[model samples]
Target chain A: MRAATASVAAEVEDLRRRYGAREALAGVSFRVARGEIFGLLGPNGSGKTTLFKILATLLPATGGRVRLLGLDPAREARAIRRRLGVVFQHPGLDPKLTVLENLRHHGHLFGMRGRALAGRALALLGGLGLDDRAHERVETLSGGLARRVELAKALLPRPELLVLDEPSTGLDPGARRGFVAHLDRLRREDGVTVLLTTHLLEEAERCDRVGILDQGRLVALDTPGALKERVGGDVVVVHARDPEALRAGMRNKLGREPALVDGLLRLEHPRAPELVREVMEAFEDEVIAVSFGKPTIEDVFIRLTGRRLREGGPA
Target chain B: MMGLVLPVTTLWWREVVRFGRQRSRVVGAVAQPLVFWLLLGGGLSASFRPPGAPPGTGYLEYFYPGIIALVLLFTAIFATIATVEDRRTGFLQGVLVAPVGPWGIVLGQALGGTTLAVLQGGLFLLLAPALGLAVSPASVAAVLGVMVLVAFGLTGLGLAIAWRMDSTQGFHAIMNLILFPMWLLSGAFFPASGLPAWLEWAMRVNPMTYGVAALRHTLYLEVPVAAGAVPPLGPSLAVMGAFAVLAYLAAVRAAGRKAS
Candidate 1:
């Protein structure tokens, strides 16, 4: 299929960032259509935050171009800032102020004030279901409530583009679900374009499209279904005490080589359960356990990058 | 017109609220200069006697203007620490990404810090009578003018320092390294006389010296002696005013660069 049109809300081409001797972003590129909820999925230190910062005009890109609402982020930064709202990966709410005061301060930064500012803040808090706690200090709120306040602050100005970096990092399951639902409501009801970065697979699935980022490079970009279909077959997992030996035996006996990571052997085949039974028969008591399931986003990630999405070590 | 005023006023109000919230900071801002004024002035007065010191020159009287200058200097210098904190806490990021110009952040912070400095200077003025200094209405206004100038210069310097600093520890070190020499050499605690020739030359180039001199002149009605000859107060005010303008421009540039 042909790619979508390039009339995008945010466009970044070959964006690169260097921190002293280290290169944080190396030739990264992506585009988000207007009013689309786009997700950037990557582990820590994968240049997701750097990309977000560059787009927000908080950090200048060392090389390449970034455009938000068709204006260069570098030269037209003030114009871009006027139209963009950014919620950084870290908690940005002022702890000293109440939730309403925090929103008021955020509005003031954008040249808003008085009764209008108060009314807008109240409306935003009301929309976020946080009006009841508006008078409470941010420090007194729970992590989930604070996150909602941050979101409300970002939405106070009714920005054209919203950039959220790991917005649901420390939230509980219910909070994360509610936050995602709120984002969906914004996209559907208000038509606000959202560009979010997250490491959670389920959160990424909620986006209309996902960009899989690894080592500062976008490895894959597609809808969740497309990404999953790219894996081709059911994921057969063969757990063994010695994966190397089992993988070699499977390669030699069944003429099928599976990807072995740690103690789990993963393979994509037409009849995964049948293959699992055959493998069990071939290995007999040698195989510790065997499991088969549909391919997950994690599987796609490992297939493309040769590393688990949540696994740690080197990128 | 109201739109323009609203944003700046709201930002300024937020800073004021933040200052009020930090109880420890309020105490420190006021207490540091007052203690320094009393202890250092009293100790130095007991130990040394000038050959031709002015009459009715108690330690408090001689050190009062310096203490005021110190109040302005310390308040401005320590305000940079708040900037570093704001950066780490994501408040600075929010400000930078706002629709406002970079100068708004710089000007707002300077204005906030200056207001606090002026308030603290007022407290020092109220404590002046107990410290043997006269506080007439005109004298109070004059002292406020001098404090405003000193606050402007120091806040500009603070903004400049904060622009390049990424950590609180680095900011603290730079503040100590730069401000101590400025205060000591500017004759804030001691008269600049009897120093080595080269040291005197250094003091001549220090902007704080002119601020301290102008403040002393306004507060005590004393003429500032430059190179052993008392220069006119107009020249001293002009010198400090020039530094204030230059520092403000530099601060604005630094803030713009930081936002980038």
Candidate 2:
């Protein structure tokens, strides 16, 4: 049973959730393999939170099944809860409590106790670089340190499947790198399956596999490598004063069909380093700036959807 | 039983821990009621003659038990109404996902409030001697028991409301509209028997009325019953106990519901 459960950390089947007249999660489904970091990638209002809540067993779906650690969230929430560690998107620490006190109470809530519980809490805090700050109140900590404490609390239980919501929200670049690397270490050492939701493509890039959501539906699901490869070679983007004319001229004159997104001409070419000048010269006066490079997860989102992955966020 | 007791003890200890850290809240909750009792009781004692008063009983003496109930109410509100803050700050979200069930959570919260109310009420109990009120070991025990029930019922009511509230400002509005009215008409400030018919009925139905009546009865246990005694001791104790149990069950049920 352990081996069988080890292969699939979480499985979802056509999960649907409705909030009054609006459908939040409309027939979403995916499976996360054991020890893999799976990311649910979408911008705000794309049902990412709705999906996260359903998986957390905080909300019941209007339809379909959600199983985490081989247990149904609806039927076996308590059993799943014992094995599932969740870090919410918002700050969940008690501002008045010290870091160790917060973890002690959290452990008690999960039926943990005594010297062993203390041992585990200290171990987690030590691993997260919060050992020295153990006696400090959570409200006094910086955003990055507080986030690390939250992770320590979530990791204290040694959950088989760990779920986080926008785990990189308040962390600086270096802290974000360390956080993911810590999660990667958890996967390697403990075979813990990790899932996180993010609106930023860069954050999604850290996941082993990503499920792209749009308008309450799963648009795509694949490895980051596979998702980018779908765009093929390099993507050349041309910012032009007359984007429509530039796009038309690229297709009509150069026999090149480039997708127009956010008023920019986007062409996925096998040899974009050489094709950059061709597209720029083709619309010499019309083009303001031309760039070509390895296709990012953003380019894949544009190739798949006709819109940018995020409105505004750091790359 | 450790499953239930451990969570309850830890949560109750958490409330005490949090209370110790917040000095302003302690002063507000403990001292605010003392000021209210002194000013209100002093001003009203003159020419305030309700039926069933021992011929020479002053309003301050009469309102003494009522003020203890008020202190319990304040402490109950102080301790448990922060559930809205915890919810707003997202800490409650973390608790909800834990392995503990809703019933355990509710019990922990309700008991936490009860402990603080009992403690604060106990502090006021010490002042009873200065007020010329008698205190035997028996009366002290009796008051603590009744205060526990009264505090538990009040805190559970707060829990039922707080678990659903997303903001503390909204909670304060509701507290003023609902909780204050309940305390005011519970025969805390006045006598129930001497009231007009409809007002009498409202007082009789208010659960805190039974709590205050029980406290008064226990404090005045050695004394003879006056003509205008409220609800008698037996019925008051029964009603208050039932209220505590019923309110707790309601809070647990409310917490189990899916919050948006």
Candidate 3:
């Protein structure tokens, strides 16, 4: 038998990508341990796709070293791909093909055939609660069902590592929860290492660890809880329609400068309920809107980089 | 060995399934070539004739094999749009991320396109008898062999072009500029003779010219062993075989490029 290798699912060192003159990924380094669900959290243009492509062996990095499942992606690409299951951000399923047909083709490409392949496919469909829709065309299925099929196809070969790019892009809230629960069960039972890229805070929150990438560089890397903890305790965003007087008055009186992003003041404090009251009393006429809660990955983004996460469509 | 074979078979089967699902592709692939052959052949038969033609061979009869070659080229080229569609629809990304080698990917797609071209071209050849030509079984067999070679070459050329293109519009530009002119210069529309010196040289050197010549030579097997106007059997097959090899290599090289 081949001896077991290192437990690292993925290892990247000083990864960089350049398109013409713009650097897409600049010196990003991180490691995902075996059997861990790691999320590469970033907004649009944060180089998540570039890094994902490199790790998946679909695109080469301009400068850096990457290893997937303990094998160099450049030299041992075939070996890495053999053990890697990838779910792309775009729809990879052939819409004209039936769910079972797509899975069959995917299995055959991975050298899975005969009765064994059929049995495994059937099991995956049953496990994913799609046994009845096996013969249905992928185009006819709902977004959630199609996503389930994509997941089924990825797990068909029992891959050691599963890489998903924005797995919850088109999913509804209920479907997204089910998808997360399915991944959780997979981790609990099969111990499959997963690496996913997403811009959603809730999705990143479920990850065992996350690496926050901002503007082609890794800004922070840690557990979502620990990263949130870096923002003190509670998070508050106070929107104000004011001239320069509001900020200057608050700076002189409170002595705590709040981050003004997009004409809004964002600050973190342990006693956010009391702070919200005090800020309201101090600037009642100047305030436009206000909201407060515990810091999420979005707040961590702001706390670390004085910029909002820019809640927008999928990256 | 099974690893390579399995992926190739799966990809090839996918082409067949996709082609079958799209009924319009079948109708369009068969209909467009027939219309072109009839319109061009009928209009030119009144006046156009080669310098030294085979007796009883009018423009329609002369342009018969060229029609088959056109069917192969057009259908083969159009079928390769699946690559661009695969990229747009995100199917090719999955295949690219698979463990399969570049050779397997190229061979699977090439053979899939070749099979569709030959089958589509074979359907067009049934009209040979209706066009007043007696196509014997031997001649049909010979034409089938030539179709396989040209189909493989044309499909490889199409794959090389389509793999690099990110959009169907860019692919359309290439088809018009490169593919159509290639067919036009392949002695398909007119014979290589009775042309200017430079034009004649272009026809002689064109690889598809040999493809057209090969098909024409095979279709005349029922005729006298010695044929006129058409190039010799030896050089045409040699050129086609070389073209198939070189085009396939070029396609594999394109597919294997790291940063595209």
What are the RMSD figures for all models against the true structure? 2.9, 1.8, 2.1
Candidate 1 lDDT for residue A307 = 79
Candidate 1 lDDT, B53-147, residue by residue in tens: 55556666767777888888878876878877787888878878887765677777878888888988888878767866555677678878878
Which residue ranges in model 2 land beyond 4 Å of their true spot? A1-6, A312-315, B226-228
lDDT of 3 by residue, B69-109 (tens): 99999877776788878877888888887888778898999
Off by over 4 Å in 1: A1-7, A20-22, A313-315, B1-4, B50-52, B222-231
| lDDT by residue (tens digit), candidate 1, A120-177 | 9998888888879989889899988889988888898989899998989899999999
Per-residue lDDT tens digits of candidate 2, residues A41-155?
9878889998998888899889888888888787889888889899999999999999999999999988889999999999998988888999999989999999999999998
lDDT of 2 by residue, B1-260 (tens): 66777777777788888888899988988899899989999999887875776687778888888899999888877755688788888998898888887888888888888888899999999998897877788988988999999999999988888877767777777879888988999988988765689998988789999999899888876674632467788899999999999989888888898432
| Alpha-carbon lDDT of model 3 | 0.86
Worst 10 residues of 1 chain A by lDDT: A1-10
lDDT of 3 by residue, A133-167 (tens): 99999999998899999999989989999999999
- Model 1 TM: 0.94
Q: What is the DockQ of the complex in model 3?
A: 0.72
